[model samples]
Target: MSRLEVYDLEHNYVTTLANAYNVGYSKEENQLWDASFQLPYDDPQLKYCRPLRFIKIYDNEDEYIGEFRIWPSEKKKSMSDRQVKIELLDCLHTLTDSVLFGYYQLNNYKTDYVFNWLLNKQKNKRWIPGRVDFQRGFSYAWENENGLVDALFSIPKPFDEDWIMERDTTVYPWKISLVKPQTEVTARIIEGYNLKEFTVKESPQKLVNRVYALGDGEGVNQLTFKTINNGKAYVEDTFSQEEYGLIEYIWTDRRFKDKASQKASTEGMLRNWKKLQYTWEITALDLMKLANRPSNLAINQGREIKANELRLGKVIELITEDNEPIQFRILKESKSDIDDGKANIQLTLGNVIGNTGTTIADVERQQEINTNYANGATNIVPYIFDREADFSNPVEFKFFVDDDVRNVNTCELTVDTSHFRATSKGNTSSPQTVSSSTSSAGGASVQSATSSAGGASVQSATSSAGGSSTQTSSANGSHRHRMFSPGDLIGPLPETRYVAYGGGFVATGSPNDIYTAEAADNHTHTVNIPAHTHNVSINIPAHTHSVSINIPAHTHQVSITIPGHTHEIIYGIFEYANLPSKLKIEVDGNIVPIDSTSFERFDVVPYLSKDEDGKATRGRHTIKITPSDLARIEVQLILRVFIQSQLGGEF
Candidate 1:
């Protein structure tokens, strides 16, 4: 056993008693009574040989404060098997009061809580300095002047919820819990108001879920108060809370009225529409396009009509000067939206005419007569006097429209045929010889007389070879030059060629004469000359290109001409007057005598054969004219001889 002493060194007896000897003996066994003499509960030297006792401490709040233990020792089992029970011998009044006064107090050692001890050198427990100990554990150490005897131990633990500590000794408190409040709703509607009543209830953070309300005339209705994020629910403006609460208090409540009842009972307004018809005014003119010759009347052709106001289903009247008035009816409409209320309406009317009863054709003829008066009308009627008269003289006429609209005016026709008269055989121009009733011996001409009316006259003249004649009419007026009638000789004929008779023909070269030989049917009309002639040239006169040669019994007439030939002998068929002949001939220019023997029938032959070299010569030729102007020749011997002359060999 070990003895742990607090302060007095003279208390070594207690130490020796507990260490070397058993101090107490039992009478029954003859052993010591109390001291086992192992070691003191508190001893500085024993503590050096004792093992430490580790102690864990926690506060009242179950928070791990720290650790406490005895100092280290040399012997292993010495401190493990030892126990030191602390005790108080005599409690000092001051010490007890100080502790009871809340400064210091007895504390029970707990397995889960800590106890702190205060030690000072001046106190009785001076040898034992300060300590923090675990519950149910003891440790000891005597006073040491220069050692840290203070110790702490901790149980292996985690702190409880809401537990906190400071400096391993102090304790603190937990925070308080909060509470939420509930809410309620109320609603109402005033008299004559159209809205309903509503009610609601909820906690500040909870949903009201549903609301109830009553509608006017329609009874009560159920409404829901759906919540929003801000912990609010809104009822419709028409709902009052009391009515809504009444509805929620009672389950079944009317929410709608019958459709027929509402319609018949409810107050509403009426509406209507009206229709009208009106007239329009016009102050300007309009026009319409119509077809050609629209009416067979004397209206202004191609002229446009001027109109004023036009209305639907109305009659319109218009007049034409020198004609009758026309009435029209509006028949159709146009689409232009004329805001002036005047609509463009199509109209139809009858034909219009002019004043004269004459037809339009008659008027046209009168128009021509008004243009050329001298050629208009003539006085063909004659007087009955014996001397013949000529009354078919020219007379002029004029026309006019009468002043009376109803009557057609007759044309004022007049003639000045003072050129027409008649007379007896004895009447004479001299007044001294007037004995009209006695003898009609001399054939007499009457003088033309004039009338006051627009009139015409004709004159007659009579004459005898041995009878005295009296002349009348104008005997001294100007006269027109007389023209010569045909067959009257105007000049002496030339002895040479002249185009006097049927367009004459010219002889090729200088022939025998211009007259034909014998003037009979001369088939061998000669270009009379020496024989074996090569070519003939014919010269045609100006404006006399074509000449007809009559072969008394041939099928066609053969005509020929020359186009400005130098010797008037170039020749080809020029039958049609429009086709003038063109001739190419090699002529002998020597002038020959104008004898019948100096002429020849020059037959045209085509050149043939070559002159010994490779050059190609002419073939036997047929004289040709343009197909449009081929003429037949009456001299067949000359024609055949011309065709055969193209052969080159001696034949």
Candidate 2:
């Protein structure tokens, strides 16, 4: 026979003494300490009562260590002595708490606290199995499709994450309780009354049996609600502060399924549980209280309010104040599949933490390792495309590495097609030495194009003296002889020698006060044209010039010849000399119009005519002028004209 002792806490006021020992202890720790006194006295307390005693041990410094206690066990639980000792040791640390039991701090203490204390604080299992005594004609179905019956349960406020399903033989998946026994529900039906205005403390308990209330002409009714057959039940409980009431619930078997179902039932309860009341006093009070609060109330407000950190496929958008979906994916980070923001996410090339060929799955798995290696750095974005992309929609994504924020958008993602071609070509090029017909026999074998004969000359002559002679000679020669000389071409002069030209042509005097001299068109003049270069200066107006020749100072133009082709270079018309401007210039009878007049004055080197042996020949060059072409020139002055007159004159 086993003996026991009981300290009747509620009856003997022993809670005062128990409270003294509960100092600085958490609920778990306190439960352990409470077990030392309460465990031996469960079930038939009088039969298990005994006088319990304990010996307290103290250190040399008078600090408490622990105590040894003994009592009779009401429940003969089967466990090895070692397991019991381990349990006792765990219980012993509860007496000390973290402050005194610092050495025995459990692994993952805070996580465990969150799991056991905070997360497991509340439980709601919607499925409830209750034994029913169907009086004769009544039939009950366990898995009813339409759900003819409902099982309801209650728990305190707040919820947790660990209410998962597990197979159990004896216990129902849901938490169970008995509704307050033999409750009398008295209901009064009033016409034209606000249902929400009813109060639990003041309003008569009405419509007790059914899930909803229906009122007709009946003034009032009394309904008796009793707990059915030793199972969980719920009464018409009203929590006005929380704005909640009770409703019919569905029973389920799986604990997790019950959890979800219970939440739906509670929400339904709050929505449909209407009450009848004659006054709107509570609603008025609520209105008054709401009005007294601050104005311009807002949370997570403003437009284009980008996220501090966004994962790949994090549909960034302009949401209304009411959280309505405005548009589809505003931006795409690389390798994201989620269309909505509410999904598991990974880093992408477009996000702050760039996706570096690391797939979303890979990144998530290796996040800890990569973070450790990089010291919490966001990895570089992978090169998804050699070219840029044309991001059509606008999206702003901002993220921080510590305090440094990075932002990217369509501007950053716009693909550069040129880069892709370059890279692809480079990758495919053969490494072997290539020989092409374009390459000179004496030169390094390559196939790059050359614009002039100088490159060809040097390349061919390279086998002899490495082409140093040809390179220097060709560069200087071509530059020195670009235009034709007098001897290069023998042509008849035009019938008209000089054309009438005016407008800003200031020559020693005005147009009316000019002097003319006839030294002789009489003598048989053999004109000795010099073997010299032709150089001229002309200025263009700052604005567009008309053919009128009447425009003043700013308008200026001149002409020069190169290889029978005359190039009329213009200056001063700064506005007409932009990159896209067209030059409608004409020289002689040939019309050569340069789109722009921005060129500076430079010499057209005399063209040295080559003999059969490739040596240059030089002589005078006669330039013809025409009236129709003169209107296009903005010349200020025609300078440095050299002509020779001889005995024959026509020679």
Candidate 3:
């Protein structure tokens, strides 16, 4: 018989039990797979079944079925039989506790960046992903979701179904490629021919034709299909209205930026309401298990059958009542063991909408709406920078000076004469002279002379009383002339002309900008400027960068323009708009402060603007920000008005 194997967190073999009875694993669409079995009251390896350890289930062939997570100390004991029953949870359930920290204001996030970021960042070791495929193209925006599961479900099924958020059966167990509804499988569930028993169900519970699709704007400005649909804001399906009177549904998708797309979506939704939803519950006998096996009861073939052909996520042909042919896929499966060895597997088969991500149309929304909205906005994001972001302190704006010297405008410059002296290499603006001559009977005493002007000369002549006398009188000295003596002034001082934006610096290219000037006057004076703000430090409490990160336990203050209108506000409580957790929002005029649980909980109502009727009350409301020591929180408040008031007419 197939056995149950236990592995530690590291996947090292811990224990194996071939003796477990009534063992089977079942799966539900979009939910984690579950399994349960009874062990003898005195089993020794029961200790290995604690939380964090993993359990693997296999069929009699011992081929891989799937892996499940264990919860701490969940065991049921029947005193009369002394058998203990333990239930198993799939690895995805751990996401229920793990959280993405912070509030996000997502504009248009790509399909893969959303997944990779959630699975690999700012989370505890509660769960880890084995593999993640990077998907290009932005698919989601301005939305909020709860657990990782709910957040993932909010994403539309990728065109490549393999890229949907799903887990593997064994290899790379946490990767998304689904295991079933696969085109490669050849499986059939035929009436009486193979099905042990079957129940057919048809319901109009989720059927709809009149879709009231609403998008981003509020009040009369709300984007709707009315303009393009002649006179009706809502499009009607003739078939559904004929068969079921009228089924009305409201879809508020804030992601839509315009009306034309809403028209196409409404028409698409009209097409799906043609028929009532259909489902089939069956207890299909395991045909492969009884082909040769004789030891196990033909009725008890469940234990011997892995149901490989009818595995979850696989598509199968079903010949129903009256030999009517229809295609269905296994969506949900339940197991039971009756007396000795007779085991039965009940399968919930449905032809629901689905991609290849999971077999039972697990990717479909539980609610009725235009599935087209699931194809989230695919417009190329112009940019992803948020106006309000959580930024690290001391942000730096660099001013890079180029290697080559920049040109300056040719102009005259002047400064306080007391703080400057007029002098040049060869000449000065004004010339001053110094000349000296001595006539004496005796030879002239040793004398030294210097001139502040160039062109000063010396002449030799015989002095009176037969003593030689020299006379020097000229315009000034030669090229070595200077107006000020070296001792008269202290210079060679570096230029301290402060360059700033407004006065001399041009933020953008324009005439008279200092950075591009051809020439600058070289006068010895200071370019004294008023204190400037461009190079000063500033503290912005609520800010963020292109890369979003988790903030510590902190509060952020914000003031946003919230219009008073009737609308629906859905915000993610994971990290940001897409993922936010442990968040708090307090309006200035309101008394009660609202806080969501840390990373794991979400409360959609009362955060933004809302009225008593679940729509927002008309009026401006201020969102108050408190002070704290963590990253500032930014909320992408999306207001969606579902009804139009300006029409002023009855339908």
TM-score, per-candidate, Cα-based: 0.09, 0.14, 0.47
**Tens-digit per-residue lDDT, 1-651, candidate 3:** 767888887677788975688777787766668887777778887777777678888766564667887764445566567767787888776565654333233334665566655655325444445434444353343222334654454443323233234566465335553222344324666565567898777888868878787765545555576756776788777777888888888866544543554555555555555558776788876544444533222212243423235656566667676866666666776656422244456888755344223222432443322332232221111111112222232111111111110111111111110111122232223333433333234323443443243333344443333233344333433232123422234433243334464356423222222333233333233343443333333343443234334434443444444334443444433333222233333443443344531221222234435444333344444543332222333233222223212212467
Task: Give the per-residue lDDT digits (tens) of candidate 2, residues 1-651.
Answer: 111112231212121121111111111101122222223222333232332432232222232323322344333345431111101121122112112110111222222232222212223322243322111111111111111111111111012111111111123232222211111111111112211232223343422222322111111111111123122233234543234334343321111112222333333333323333211111111111133423221223442222322222233322233335322221121111121222222221111111111111223323332232211112232112121111221112221111111111111112111110111111233334333334222323333443332211122222222212122222222122123332235343333233343433323322223223222232232334334443444444333322322323242233433233333444332222112123332222234333233233322122222334222222322221122111222221111211111113244
Best candidate according to TM-score: 3
Q: Sort every candidate by lDDT, greatest first.
A: 3, 2, 1
* Candidate 1 off by > 4 Å: 1-117, 120-122, 127-651
Residue 290, model 2: Cα distance from true site in angstroms:
47
Q: Clash number for every model?
A: 72, 36, 41
In candidate 1, what are the lDDT values of residues 473-560, reduced to their tens digit?
Answer: 4345433433332224334333434343346554332323234322333122223333332333444333313333433322333344
The global C-alpha lDDT for each of the candidates, from Candidate 1 onward, is 0.22, 0.23, 0.49
Lowest summed lDDT across 10 adjacent residues in model 1 is found at: 266-275
Cα deviation of 466 in candidate 3 (Å)? 95
Please tell me which predicted candidate would have the highest lDDT against the true structure.
3
Question: 545 in model 3: Cα distance from truth in Å?
Answer: 92
Deviation in angstroms for 257 in model 3?
9.5
